[model samples]
Target: MRIVILCGGESSERDVSLASGGAVARALLERGHEVVLVDPAAETPVLAGPLHFGDVVDEFAVGKEPPSGLGRRLLQERMEGALTAGPVLGLLRDADLVFLALHGGWGEDGRLQERLREEGIRFTGADSTACTAAWHKGRGQAALGAAGLPVAERAQWQPGIEGVPQAVRLLLAAGPVVTKPVADGSSVSVHRVDSLAELERVAAETGSGGVELLVEPYLPGREFTVAVVGDRALPVVEIELSSPLFDYTAKYQTEGVSEVCPARIPADFASRLQELALRAHEALGFGAHAYSRTDFRCDAAGEPMCLEVNALPGLTATSLLPLAASGAGWTYGELIERIVDLAMS
Candidate 1:
C-alpha cells in the first residue's frame, strides 16, 4: 500500500505532528508499505521517497516550544491557499490512504478532513463531522456528559463578550480553575489558576480575538488517558507531572512528566475508565474512527472525569497512545498496520 502521511499543519502542534508523521511513516515502511511524507502547510510532498525515520525524527526531536510566530505564518499561508490543493492533496489522491498524524486546529478540527473528503481521499482517524465535534471542548463535553459519561463542569468564553469576564470571574471565585483554548490539543495554553487574578491574567494572555476559551474547575488528581482503536481500548496510561499543570512543555519537551502504561490502578477502575472512554468516543460519533484517545483526571473519590477526546491522537514515540499500545502488546509497526487496516476496512 502507498500511504501519504499528512502532517505538520500551522496549528500549535506542528512540531509534535512532524514527529508523529515521521514515526508513522517509518512504522508503515517497516511493515513493507510505501510511505510519502508531506506538510500541507508547505504545499509540497517530500518527493524524494521515504527518508530514514530516525533522520526525520531527529529534525523535530528537540523539546523546545513551537513558536507562535511560526503558527501565525503557517496559518497565513494556509488561509491564502485554503482551497488550493496544489501537490500535497494531489499526492494523497493517488495513495491507498493518508495517515493523519497532524493534531490541533486545522489538522484535527475537521477543516483538513473536509478537504480530503471533497477530494475523495481516504484518511485514518475520525471523519470530518466527528473531528469537528471532538475538537470543540464545550460541545464535546456536553455531548459526552449527556450520554451519561462523567465530565467536569465547564464554561466557554469569548474574549470580548459583554458578560463573559464576569461569568468567568464567577467560575474562578468558586475554586481553582483550568483555562485552555476551547479547540486545541497537546495541552497548549492549559493552566490551573487558584485565584481570580491568575485567571484574569491567563484570560488576557491566552485570549485572542479569534480563539475562544474553555474554563473548568481544576480537578486535582491523577491523570490517565485511554486509547481506543476500533471499539477496543488498548490500555490506560497514567500521566504524572511534577509541575502543577501538564502543559505543552511537559508533553513535547520531555520535562517534568512521566507516563506509566497499564496504569497502576485497580482492575475494575481501569475497566471503568476504558468503558467510559469508549462511551465518550461513541457519543462523539468517533466509533468508526481508526482510533481516538480520551483524557481523564480522577476526582477526590477516584471517579474518572472526562477531559476531552483526541480524534487524531499523537503517535510520536513518547506519546501516550503508543505507550498504551505497547502495554497492550502491539509494536509500533503493528499498531500502525492495525490503524491502516481499520481505516481501509
Candidate 2:
C-alpha cells in the first residue's frame, strides 16, 4: 500500500500529531508498506503547516528539530510547500490512500474528509458530517444521549447576549462543573472549578480565545477510556493520573500517567463500557473506516458514566490506540498495518 499520512495541523494538538505520524510512519514501514509521511510542515506545491481547517496554523517546522543539516533543509523546504492552497483533495490526487493522523480543526472535525469526498479520495473514519458531529463535544454528547446511551450530565456555553445566563444555567444543572473549550481535545483549558468564583475567574481569563466552553458534572470514580476500532471494542485502557484529575501535562510530556488494560474492572462492567463505546461510535454514523475512543467514569459500584468520545484518538506510539492494541495482542506495526488495510478497503 502506498500510504501518505497527513500529519501536523493548525490545532493545539499539532505537536502530538507529529509524534503520532512518526509512529505511524515507522509502523507502516516495518510492515513493508511504501509509506510517505507528510507533515503539513513538509508539503511542497502544497500547504503543509498548521491549517485550522484552513484558518490557523500550528507550524510543524521540519528544520526546527534535531537532525542532519541536509535532512533538515530538505524537510524544511518540503514542509514549506504544503500550505499552497488549491485543496488537500487536489494535493492527494496521486495517493492511493490517506491515513489521517491529524487532530482538531478541519482535519479531525471532518472538514478535510468532506473535501476529500468531493474529490473522491479514499480515507479512514466516518463521513465528513459524522466527523463534524463527533468533533463537536457538546453536540456529540447530545447525540449519544439521544441514542439511549448512559452518559454523565453536562452543559455547553452557547455565545450571545445570554452567554452568562446560559453558562449559569449549565452550572446550576451540573456541578461542581468541569469546564473547558468545547471543541478542544486532550483536555486543554480543562479545569475542575468547584466554586463559582473560580469559574468566573477562568471564564474571564480564558474568554479571549473565543471558543465556547462546556461545563460537565465532575463524576467521582475511576477514569477509564474504552478504545473502539472498526466495529469492535479493542480493550479498556484505564487512565491513572498522578493528579486527582487528568490534565494536559498528564496527557503528553509528563510521565505522570499510566494506563491499565483489561482494566482490572469486573468483566460485566468492562463489557458494558465496550458496548457503550461501540454504540456511541455507531450513533455518530461512523463506518468500518472510522475509529473512536469512548471514555467513561466507573463509580465504586462499577456503573459506567459515559464521557464524550474522541473520534480522532491520538496515533502516536504511546497513544491510547496503540496502547490498547498492545494489550489486544496486536503489535504496534501489526495494528498500523491493520488500520491502513481498513483505511482503503
> Best TM-score goes to which candidate?
1
Query: What stretches of model 1 exceed 4 Å from their correct place?
Result: 43-59, 70-83, 163-166
Score each candidate by Cα lDDT.
Answer: 0.81, 0.70
lDDT of 1: 0.81
**lDDT tens digits by residue: candidate 2, 234-309:** 8888998787677666777447788788688778877878888899888988877778888887554757777778
Whole-model lDDT, model 2: 0.70
* Per-model TM-score on C-alpha atoms: 0.93, 0.84
Tens-place lDDT per residue, model 1, 120-167, is 889888898889999999999999989999998888887755445666
Q: Name the TM-score of candidate 1.
A: 0.93
Candidate 2, residue 310: Cα displacement in angstroms equals 1.3
